[model samples]
Target: MSQQLILVLNCGSSSLKGAVLDNASGDVLLSCLGEKLGLPDAYITFKFNGEKNKVQLSSNPNHTGAVEALMEELKKHGFDSSIAAIGHRVVSGGETYSESILIDEAVIAGIEKCIPLAPLHNPANLLGIRAAQEIFKGLPNVAVFDTAFHQTMPEHAYMYAVPQELYKQHGLRRYGFHGTSYRYVADEAARFLGKDKNSLRMVIAHLGNGASISAIAEGVSKDTSMGLTPLEGLVMGTRSGDIDPAVFGFLADNAGLSVSEATDLLNKKSGLLGLSGLSSDCRAIEEGALEGHPGAKLALEVFVYRLAKYVGSMAVAAGGLDVLAFTGGIGENSDIIRSKVLDYVSFLGFTEDKEANTKARFGNAGVITTADSKAIAVVIPTNEELMIAQDTARLSGL
Candidate 1:
């Protein structure tokens, strides 16, 4: 008998990442990401049985087109019949969903209600769901929310200081992002230390294009950096992480910018991109900094400083950190970023082994801290696809 498989789909605004995982063993059999969707260079690169392959579409493919192309690719590999269910990564579940659930009409309605909150993500997520449902008829589908893990945060941590009516009427609060990544890495960090997740106080820093940090005590999220939307967290690649609310009014009055214009500026044109006046990528920024590019050097400094500050704050939220973890693109790959962050927080008795950190990139996991350090620092690669697949399998009983 063939092994059962779970298809996990994570759709961003412009990208769709799909993976086929063994439902019993949770090993990824195939993985792919269709990037540059709706553009001239829209193409897909997938791995089948550990072999990498690329498919460039002659015509620009939307979400539906992308899904159809992937299905065709899977049929070519002769594994299309092995799929048991589909799992989707929905960005915002609001206060409705605290765990992964089977997708149905009501669940689709619930996801649609969150489109106002996750303008860029939820629509694309819904597109993936609708397309998958259409193409894979009769298969069970599950929705795993990215904000679900952080729903454990207390009222004080999630509540904003704005008018109480705003939250009551509009559901305005700190609904953290990257919950799936944090949950995966936090568990991975606990396992790496040979400790139970429920016994450790951990600070998980998920640094990527959209960065956020969470304070977890006893495996439950206590507080997180992102609030309301992903736009309110630590400095991201293009999003302005945190700023005074008055900046909006100031920009309106001084620069003659409207609310939407200001929102676009902050969400699309700020952060390292704005500060460096160059690329938003940390690797490029780091390279530019080494070359004495003033803007790039300043951006790198600001990013490291903000990360260290947030990690220190998270430690307080965790009631004294037992472990510090780095995940996501920047966190897992950029050795310089990790070393700089550890140095800034060395006051907490966290010392990093430079050599160990250098080798922890590209799917490698390791302990990067000294033996005598007060807190353990780990570099754990996150696997949200595996998490989503597990949730799908358990919920579907596949």
Candidate 2:
């Protein structure tokens, strides 16, 4: 049997990230990124066989141009014909899809119908799908949604406490994001603990520039942090998470800002950046906090407190926590943050192993809690691209 390779495409508003992975072994054969799309200095960088190369694209390049450039690079690397299918990281499937599936006419319509829910992401996802179809004709295309895993959330957990008509007519309810990362880490946490996923109650915190947490019971999502969009969760790099609805009116009255401007302020200028009045990067905040910067100290404190509170709530939602796992850019790398969070949640019977916590950074995965602790706390690195590639290969029968 020949090797099954999957081309995973993640299209964003201003860039494209593509990776070719071996389905059986989960090894990344090649990866490339096209940046500065729709700009005069658009270019692509490819990394393969431990070597990196950069290629320039036409001025103001679009998704089609990026795909064409990727194809040429693939052919040059002799990986074009080996690809079994293309997988796309779609942001929202709404209620139309519960899991990863092959892309078809009906699927396209469903994605299009959800454009209003994910205006910035769904359109770019569709562009990548269309471009892949045109460039890699006869190949199967799969959509792995960022919201699909959380579809298992009970209605009570997902529903907002709003007027029934608003929810019934406008679909105004919580639809969590970061489903792909949550799903991958949930299974990994189970495997790492030597327990069956269906028997484990896990709370995974995916902390990055964009962050969220999820409660998983028996391998299904029972609750998550993000709601309706990515902006309704824990404090992120710039996006304000979980603010009072009345803040809008307050801003309009005092700041003389319109609703759109207020919304932009919350989504683009708030969170760690707003609270610290410094950089959005967590490392910078940590450094400033260590230096006794009042703004950074306050930001760090609020971020930790909010995260611990959510973790406790999720544990309740899961009926009790057996495992508390951390992943993503911040979660996996920041030992200080992890220690602070663990200190806050010590009542949950987590005793931090300081040495182990410090050693678990830079791609190392291990339990960060003591053996005598009632619950296990671990750092499990997330691999969303591998999850997407596996789903695509399985759906395509590769």
Candidate 3:
């Protein structure tokens, strides 16, 4: 097959990550990260041909500036001419999109319409899309939404207990995130297990700084931890996941905080950081726990307990878990976390291969359960960028 190059862009509020990949071979030719965008000390880091380099960007760089810098890097590496299209990682498509689609005026409007649902992410994603359109004029742009895969969820799985009119009017229901990661891992899990994708029932735990779990039955997302936004599910590095709604009113009355402040606190100040009163990084929390720090131990326990609880729920939602797969940063690297989670869910017939779990880190992917276990457990590193590139190539007819 001939090479089909697709430039994948994942833009955050103040950062842009770009990768040029051969869609046919799934090999990344070049990758770059523009950090601290719109700040005075903005800079960009690039990795290509096994070499790493960093360069300072203009003062107060914006998304367009970052895209231009990426373009320059692409040109420098002679990859600019071979680019076929650009794929954007959009965080929310609401109920409007069920799959990846080419970006157009109508799509942009649809994205804008979902701004209230993903207030922080959709705008940043739109910025990246517009910047890429400007920098790479006429290149087909395809949007791969993080909520699209969960669109297959049944009505009962997505609807809230609130009045039906609210959901009908505002679309206030569960729309899971990390779908791109889930999509990648579900296929990988099937391949690793040597089973047909549609025949497997898998529960995927995407544990990272921003964590979530997904239940895939017959190769389709049935239920996921994250809801309307990414803040609804598993305890993240800083997010206080699955908190009671009353906490907002209680904090307002007792702590004299507004709804906005309470939301910010939950999304930014809680989770491992709040529980441990230390760092948000899990590695640090694990270290502190090892050192017998009470707060860190509590944080670790709560995190693991919540994670295991979700795993159990996802297992049920998937009907039966034939393969319990772990992905994302923490899922792939943290044997301690994985082992703890498995121990909690041992009732589900998952027996951890301690040796195997420890070995499946740092880009390694393999089964981490005993051969005789009823259900298989595997650690598969997620590659969302490659998924995006493939979708872009197929959708754009590259």
Candidate 4:
């Protein structure tokens, strides 16, 4: 196969993650992350050919600076000239983009219009796009939306039970996040089952620092847990999953908090951190719980309960669940959490194989259900970067 390279950029609020992949094989040739982008001690880490290296910047680096540094590093490794196209992960496509498209001036503008919806993400995404454009002049660029895969959701599922005008005028409805991860894992799960994707009813739970669950029926997104933003989904590292809308007003009245403050609190200071009052990491909470810490125990219980509840809800949305697969950081690594949650969903006729469940970790994919279980449970690691690269290659005609 020809060694066509596809560069993927995933610019988050605080980090810029880039990977150079062999477009034909979807194999990552080089991967790097620019961390603490806006901080004084910003730095970058690169991994290539099984070797990891780090470089500390002398001063704070913005998105453009990060991209520039990454390009320079790739050039040193002689991978720059192999690049055929660049793929950017834009968080919101709103009502416009349902699939990856070649990034042009109009597409950039469309992404810009979504700034109000993904205020924290789109701008940062734009910064990366502009930076890559300058560095890789004339390279075909593509915008792969995080919300694109979920665009298949029916109106009843994405619509909020509010005034119609709110949705019509402000787009105030559920535009699920993590569509990229969900898309990759859904297809992978189908392949693992040796069945056609379009014939399966699957509920995928992507549990990570930021988490969301997706319900896919007939190879289309039927419903998802996330809403107008990622904060509306399952409990995350620091995010509160589901909450009463009235709590915002209540917090303002009694806690002297503004809407923005309340929003930040839920997105950054709640979840496992608030519940455990020890740490936001599941591993840390697991350790604390083992030590008989009540808060940590409660947090773990809450997280598992919420995950089980959403799995049940998604099964309902898909009419019935044939495959229940877990992916993402916690889902891939934490066997205990998966086992506990599966216990709650036993009514679905899923029986967990304790040994297999404990062994699936670090990108190792396997089935964790009893041979005769009615419902199949498996662990499939997600590869959003490969999905982005594939979309970029396809749309760019590489």
Candidate 5:
């Protein structure tokens, strides 16, 4: 096969995350696009294929603008401009896709049409693809949906008790997110454990700013936390995890708040920040709580409680976990979360080597579980971008 360059674009509701990777060597030729468009002082950073030199470009460019700027910068940075294809991290696939797909005008429209299903994210994801189509004209584009892997979810798991008409007309249903992250970590965890991906019954906690746990059976997503939107899952940086649907009605009737207002409050001002009244960062919360900050202490407790509950729930979903894996910012880096989560699952066969967990630096991935434990726990740093690049390369025949 000829050398192929695959670029992955990850667009958030308000910002851009992207990378250009070499397929054969598994090297990142470019690793930037963090520009928060319309927000000055925002910057883009890159660690170019192991070069000691790191590059930064400042100016908070939003998703669309940032994507174009990155394309321009690629040539200027002396990158090989012949990209074989582009891969996009689309958040919702609705019922349209069961796997990674080569992008077409019709496919793009289908993805865009699902915006209502993932109002907060799919649109921004669409923006990135729209920009890529215009900037990288003639190049093949692939969309690897965050909900794609979960499409394997059984109907009973994804179906709501709501009227069938609502789903048929508005696509109202559970479409789990963070699939790319789970997929990468699951495969890597199996490789690290010297087991085949399809052979393990593992519980994967993709804890980060947005957190979710997946029950992986035979290498496919059997169950996941995030549903419809990221807010439906485990407690996260700013989004409320699972909540009673009646709360919306109660608040609307008595609190004088509209549904939209309530939604914003939950998605942007809740979670760790709401609970702590401090920063949303777990590190800050852990440090503050340890020092006797009341709100922080409560916040940390709640966070851990929610995580423990879900981890245990997923263990049941997987029919009991043989291995438990943690990935994402908090999952891979927060020793405190690891300790707390493991402690909660001790009854369900989780083991932890405190010294090993605290010292592990996670990019290359390793086992954080102890030798004597029945259930092996690991910290596998996620690389959704690499997975996207690989998928795009495969689909594009590069």
Candidate 6:
């Protein structure tokens, strides 16, 4: 038997989140988060066996340093040496994948081909891969893509009404992100609802720094919020969700700004933080709103409004919704946000349990819907790392 440990490397533009798991038991042996690497500020932390700890990396760290740091901690802080595999989270599949697959040079090249579509994400993901290859040189590492689940979305839903030539020439269509998380939660929802995995329809809301809603029908992704890019999705931490294209030309004509500059403003300066001046984080806005901050109130309201509208539309797109789930930092932790989302859909058989909701269950999956409610409301903490580990195991035959 192969005593393999699969490590998940999730490298974002400015940070890294990784976890090493024991494939036999699905236990997370080690998880590390390196923040601000390659940026002005940087710090590294390691969560050993899912415990909060100060697993430190050296000063002036970058992506490579972050990977090295985690390996050192594993050696020092007690992890089995049977780690035989690594799993990487690659964001954009760009029609190259419909499922998680084994990683090789060709897979790496395929990911690189998707860089233009995901300029900000794919390169960082590749960095994590390279870092693992350097540190764990002999191990088999697999890649689990975030766009793989949405491959089931029909072209009518995934395609944009733009010139077919651009899409035909550039492979430019809606390649959604968060497929791993959505798939993870959707499966859990089916289990929680006691529905057969292949026949259930669920709407999963993954709300966090980057948020998206997916409508999964008969265990396949039918529609999702994010489009061609993350910027097109629901209003994100800093990215403006959806905007009128005509505004770009108008801003250029009236404000004398370039397309790139306008694009930057929408992606970096506009969203909850821009609308709420108090903070980009949902918790901060909720607190600020309680303290009578106008910007905070506006931000909170807009965020919830965006969520409710999308949930309704997703239900319509799915033909109907059997279950509605919440996951991610804000979705699982924030009761206020959950309440707001539920309130908008009361007419659709969603009713909340105040007592159960008040007791926030971080990382636990359960129904928060009222006993009599037809459409269930659930809080399912996402486990992207576990999904990565599972994929890695399947590919490595461990």
Question: Model 2 clash pairs?
Answer: 175-228
The residue pairs in collision within model 6 are none
Steric clash count of candidate 5 = 5
Model 3 misplacement above 4 A: 1-3
Tens digits of lDDT, candidate 6, 1-398: 23677788899987999887777888777778898888645677887544676644446478988888888887885563777788999999889989998878999999999999899999999999999899888888798999999999998999999999989899879988899999888888777778896776688899998899989888899999998889886877898898898989999999988999998988888889999987788889999999999999999989999989999999987889888889999889989988988999999999999777877567666788889998888998898999988988888888
Residue 117 error, candidate 6, Å? 0.9
- Clashing residue pair totals per candidate (backbone < 3 A): 0, 1, 0, 0, 5, 0
Error of 5 at 341 (Å): 1.2
Tell me the whole-model lDDT of each prediction, alpha carbons only.
0.90, 0.93, 0.93, 0.92, 0.83, 0.86
lDDT per residue as tens, model 2, 36-116? 888878888999989999988875388888899999998997888898899999999998888999999899999999898
User: All candidates: CA RMSD in angstroms?
Assistant: 1.8, 1.3, 1.2, 1.3, 2.7, 2.2
Q: State model 1's lDDT.
A: 0.90
Deviation from truth (RMSD, Å), model 5: 2.7
Model 6 clash number:
0
Sequence-dependent TM-score of model 5: 0.92
Can you write out model 1's per-residue Cα lDDT over 1-398, one digit (the tens) per residue? 34588999989877999998887777877889999887877888898767888888656477777888888887997778988999999999999999899999999999999888898899999989998998888999999998999899999899998899999899999999888888888888988899999989999999998899999998999999999888887998999898998999999999999999999999999999999999889899999999999999999999999989999999988999899999999998999999999999999989899899899999799999989999999999998999998899899997
Tens digits of per-residue lDDT, candidate 3, 1-398, equal 23568999999999999999987788888899989998978888999988998978875388998898888888897788889999999999999999999999999999999999999999999999999999999999999999999999999999999999999999999999999999999999898888998989899999999999999998999999999889998999999999999999999999999999999999999999999999899999999999999989999999999999999999889998899999999999999999999999999999999999999999999899999999999999999999999999999987
Candidates ranked by lDDT: 3, 2, 4, 1, 6, 5
Compose the digit string of candidate 4's lDDT tens values, residues 235-352: 8899998999999999999999999999999999999999999999999999999999999999999999999999999999998999999999999999989999999999999999
Candidate 3 lDDT at 203 equals 96
TM-scores of the models, in the order given: 0.95, 0.98, 0.98, 0.97, 0.92, 0.94
lDDT of 3 at 370: 96
